[model samples]
Target: MGTSYWRGELWLGPDYGLVQGQLGHTTAHAHYAHQLIIAVGSPVTVELDGVRHSGHCLLIPALQRHAMVQAPDPAFSLYAEPLRIAASDLQRCVEGVEASLPKLQAALEQCPRQPIADPRVERALQALDATLEGKVAATQLAAEAHVSLSQLERLFSRDVGLSVRRLVLWRRLRLAMALVLQGQSMTQAAHGAGFADSAHCSRTLKALFGVSAGQALKTLNPRLLA
Candidate 1:
C-alpha cells in the first residue's frame, strides 16, 4: 500500500468541482461548499456530528462538520457552492451504489441554477476570486461590494452560509491545488496562493480535506485536470 490513493479524473472550478478515483481517508472537517459523495465498487463511511454513516451515496451541507472515515476505491465526490446549488438539487443525485459517473454528472447538469439574490454578495465574491493570488482585506471587499464591513459580513452569512474569510481560505486551497497540478512544489504553490508558507498551506489543507499538500499531489498524480 502507498500514500498515493486517488485516481481517475479531477475537475476544479470556482463554484463547482468533481474528483473521482480511489478515494482517500479524511479527518473530521467542514468546508464552505456542499459535498456529495457517491461510492463506486463499495460503500464509503462518513462521520458527522459524532455519528457514523456508511452508504454508497452521502450528501453533506455546507459548513456541516464531517469526515471521510473510509473512502473505498472508486468514488465520485462533488463540491458545489451553496449559493448556486440547492440542497434539494443535490438530494436528487443520490442514487446509491448503482450510480455511475455519467449518471451523476447528468444529474448535476440538470440541477437548477439559482442566481445569487444579493448583488452586493455577488460583487464581493467576484472581488475575492480575482484577488486570491494576492492579499485581500475585509474592508477592501466591503468597498468592492459597496457596503459597510458589518453589512458585508451579514450578506455573506445570509447568502453563502459561511464567513468571507473562510471562503477566501477555501478558494486559496483550490488555487494551491491548481498550482500543484501545474508542476509547482508545495512551497511554491503556497506562496502563489498568498499563504505565509508551505507549512501554513499544508495545515490548512489537512484541516479542510484531511490530506497534506504532498499527499494530495501524489494521490492526484497524472489524473488531475485542474
Candidate 2:
C-alpha cells in the first residue's frame, strides 16, 4: 500500500490545535501538546509508556510519550492546549472532534481553567510561542512573569507538562513546521526556528516526533491553518 496520509482539516492557534488524517507507519515520539484521536472508520492504536492502547477514542496528555499508527484506516486526532484541557473536557472534546470541526474548535476554546490560571505562566508561554529564533533567557522570562526563576520553572512544569527549556525547543520545531510549508529549505527553516542547523533540527524532530521533517511533510498534509 502507498504510505502517504491526507489531512482532513487542521486548526491551529497559540493555545490549542487539532489535525486529522489517514496515517501510515509512524515513529514513536512525544510532543508538548495533549492529544486526542478517534478513528473515522477503523480502529487506531497508540503505544504509550509500555502498553499498546487501541480504541475508537482516546486522549494522551502532554509530555507523555506515545507513538501512533492508524492501522491502514481513516483517522482523526486533536491536539489540545495541555493547560486548557480539563479532566472533564476530554470526553466532550473528543466527541466534538467527531461531531463537527467547528464544535471541536469551540470545545478547544472554552476557558475552563480561566479562574485558576496563572497569568505569569501564560505570559511565559506566550513569550515561548513568539520565540521564532534565538534563546530567550529564563531569568528574563521569570522577570516577565513576575516570578522567581525557580517559581517560574515549577509553574511551567506543573502547567505545561514541560520545563521552560523543553517548551522553547518545542515552539521552535512547531514554527519550523510552518516555515517548511512556505517552501523554506530545511536548513533555512532550522536556522529561522532558532536551531544550530538543519542537522540539529532533524535530530530534534526525530527524537521528539519520531520522524524527520521531510518524512512528516510526506506523511500528512495541512488542509487548513486556522
Candidate 3:
C-alpha cells in the first residue's frame, strides 16, 4: 500500500464495538461491514456502488466498495453492527438528530439493543464474540449456536453484512488499534492482537481500509476519540 496522504483520527470504540473515524481526506477502500456516517463537520458525501450520495447520514452496506471525501471538514462514521441495525430505528431517528456531540451520543446509544428478535442469530454472535481471543471453527460455532453450519453462514451474510471470518478479522484489527492506543508498540500490538507480525498487520489494515498502520497510528488519542 502507498502513503495514507490523509489527516484525521481513527479509533476503536468499546470492545466488540464500532470502529469510528473522524473523517477528513479519503482513499478508496472496501471495509468488512456495513458503514454509517452521520455528517458532523460537513455534509457527508459517499461514492458507493456507481452513484454518489450526499446526506446528513449515509448508510453503506457491508463489503460494498466506496470512498468518503469531505476534505477540510470532518464527518463521523460508525461501522454499525447488524444486530444493532436490526433492533434500532436508526433511519427514523438519525435524520432528526442534530449533528452535535451530545445528541449524536444519545442517539447512537439507543440504536442497538441486544438479544435481538432472533435468539439463534444473537446466540451465534455472542458465541463469536466470546471466541475472539482464539480460533473457532465455523462448524464449531454452528454447533455451539445449535444451528447448522449453512444456517450460520446465511444468518451472518443476511444480518451482520459480512462473513464470519471477515468479522473476526475486523475484530482483530480493532483490537490492534486499541492496543496501540494503550501505548503498545506496533510489534506488540500485532502479536497481542493475533497477527503473525507487524508487517502482517500493516498489510491487512491497508487492504481493509487503504490506510497504513503507521499513518493511522498517529491518529490515536484516548481522551478524545476512544
Candidate 4:
C-alpha cells in the first residue's frame, strides 16, 4: 500500500460534484449516488461487493458496497445524483481513453435542468438541504412536504433512491467532511455537523468513506473550489 496522503480539489454543484487529485485506498463503503472514478497515471483496483475489479475507469452503481483497493497518485471521482443524471449518460461522457476532468465537468453542466416533477419530494429535499447540520428530523421533513411519515418515506425511496434517514446522514457527512478539510478539529467538525460526539462522527466517517476523521483532516487537504 502507498502513503495515505490524498491532496485534492473538490468542486461542488447542486446535484453533482467532482474530486480531483492524489487518492489512496478506501475501506469498504457505499454511497447514495452513482460514482465514476477515473484513475490517473495507472490503473486502479476496486473491490465491489467482495469482487475485485481493475480498470482505468470504473463506475459504481448507487448504494453498492465497494472500496478502492488500489489507486495511483492522482484520481478523479465524479458523483452524480441519480435523479439529475442517468448512469448511461455519465458513462458515455467518460468512455474510452480520452476521458478527463474537464469532460466530466462538461457532463455535469449538460445535465437536464428540469426540476423533479413531484412537489412533495422536492420540498422534502429542500428541507434537508436547508438543514445541513442534521438538526431536522424526518417528521419535520414530512411536515414540510405536507405528507405523512409513511408517505414521505415512500416518496424518498421512490424519487431519491435513499431513505430519509440515509439522506440526512449523507448531508451531514458532506458538511462534516468539508469542515474537516477546512482545518476544524474532529470534535468541532462533529458538533458543527450535528453529530452527537466525536466518536459518532468518527464511526460514521469510517463507515461512509472508509477513513477516520483524524486521517482525513491530516491527509486529505481538499481545497474547495468555487
Candidate 5:
C-alpha cells in the first residue's frame, strides 16, 4: 500500500521566532533560549546543552540551552511563550494547552515511550535521520522492523505518541524549509521535497508556517537573494 498523509500544524506565540531550516545532514546553529517545543511527529532525539531526549514533545523554559537533530524524515515544531512553571504546574499548563490544542494534544496523548530492549524504533529513526529529502512508506518501515503494518502502527502510537503518516508530513515540511534556507529555488525545493509542484509547496508552507515560501525565503537572511 501507499504511504499515508498526515497533517502537522504548529502555533507560535508572538515572542518566538523561527531560527533555522537545514537538511537532515546539515547542521543548524542558533543561540539557545528558553521556549517550549511541541513535536508533531514520531519520537525524535533532541539534544539540548549536551543532554538528549527521545520523546514525543517537550516544554523547555528559558535559559535552558538546547539544539535538535530531527529524525531523518521531516519533523514539525512550535515555540510557545516561556513560562516559569514547576513540574507540577507545568503539567497543569500542559493540560490547559492540550485542551486548547485538541489536534496536537490528541497526537501527544497517544504517544508511547520507547522500549529499552527492542531497537526497531531506533533503526527506523536512523533511516529517517539519514536523509532530509526523500519519501518513506509505513509498510516499508514496518517490514524493516519485522512487524506487520498494524503492529507497527500500534508500536509507534504506543511509544512515540503519533502516527507514521503525521511524522512523514512533518519531515517533508522540515526539508522544504531547509532547502529554501539553503538558497534553493522554490521550484527546486518544492520538487526536491516531494511536493506536487511549487504551488503545492507554497500552499502547504503558508498553511503551516504562516508565510508563503517566497516570504520565508526572503526572511531567511537580512540581505535578500536575487
Candidate 6:
C-alpha cells in the first residue's frame, strides 16, 4: 500500500496516545521528562543541545532537552518510553522502529542505555550554517557535493539523524528567530525567512515552538538576543 500523507499517530506508552490529522506546522516544547522517538516522511529539522539536524529519524533522550520544528510537508511522529531502550541501542532501535511498531513496543520492555558515536554529518551542517539567511535547496547542496539526492539522503540519515529538507526548515526557523531578535516585525521576519507572510510565519513558529512569534520573543533572555 502507498503511504498515506494524512494518516499518522503518536505511540506514547499505553498511558498516553496522540493522533495528528492536519497539514500544518507542528512543534513540541522543550521537555525534560520523557524521551521521544520521531519518524517523518518529509524532511524535518530538530534542535537539540544547540545543534540542528535534518534527515531520516531522530532519537531524543529524556531530560536531555530539545525542540522539534516540522518541515512544510506532512509528517508522522512516535514517542516511546525512555526506559524502553538503552543509549547504546538507540541507533538500532531507531532504524527498526517503523518496520515493526509492535516489536518496538515489546523492546521497550527493557530500557537499556547504549552509547553511540555522533553521526558527525558535517558537510550539510556547514552549508546550512553558512547560508542560514540565504535561499538554498537540497538539490543544490547535493550537486555541489557531487552526490545524488538519494546519496545525500543516506548521508543525512547516517550522519545528521534527519533529512535535507528538515535542515532547510530548521535553518529558516533559526533565521526567523534571529530576525525577530533584531526587532524586526513579524511581517519582516516572515519575508526575510522566505515565508509567504507574517501569518504563515506565526503558524510555523507556533507549531514548532508551541508559541507565537510575540510570545517567543518575550521569553528570550535580553542578553541572548543582544
Q: Which lDDT values do the candidates have, in the order given?
A: 0.77, 0.70, 0.65, 0.77, 0.49, 0.52
After superposition, which runs of candidate 4 have C-alpha atoms over 4 Å from their true positions?
95-103, 181-185
Q: Judging by TM-score against the true structure, name the best candidate.
A: 1
Error of 1 at 65 (Å): 1.2
**Model 4 compared with the native: what TM-score?**
0.84
Q: List runs of model 5 lying over 4 Å from the truth.
A: 1-118, 129-134, 222-226
Ranking by TM-score: 1, 4, 2, 3, 5, 6
- List clash counts for every candidate, in order: 0, 0, 0, 0, 10, 18
Model 1 segments beyond 4 Å from truth? 1-8, 93-103, 222-226
Order the candidates by lDDT, highest first — what do you get? 1, 4, 2, 3, 6, 5
Residue 6, model 4, lDDT: 57
Model 2, range 8-30, lDDT digits (tens) per residue? 55556655666666655556778
Candidate 1 residue lDDT tens string, 3-103 = 24465677665456777787777668887778988776678888997899999778898888897777656888888878788876777655442455555
Candidate 6 structure quality by residue, lDDT tens digits, 1-226:
1221223332334311222322233244542123433444565676677677776556665445455554444444434323233444644544544534455554544445433342234555566556655677777677666678898888877754456876566557656656665678768887788766888777766655455665545433321111
Clash pairs, candidate 3, are none
What TM-score fits each model?
0.86, 0.80, 0.74, 0.84, 0.46, 0.45
Alpha-carbon error at 37 in model 5, in Å?
9.9
Residue pairs with colliding backbones in model 5 are 34-62, 72-128, 72-129, 73-128, 74-171, 75-171, 111-161, 112-158, 112-159, 112-161
**Candidate 6 CA-lDDT value:** 0.52
- In Å, residue 125's CA in model 4 sits off its true spot by 1.3
lDDT measured at residue 132 in model 4 versus the true structure, 0 to 100: 65
Model 4: per-residue lDDT, tens digit, 146-214? 999999999988888888988788878777766766778878888888888889888887887777765
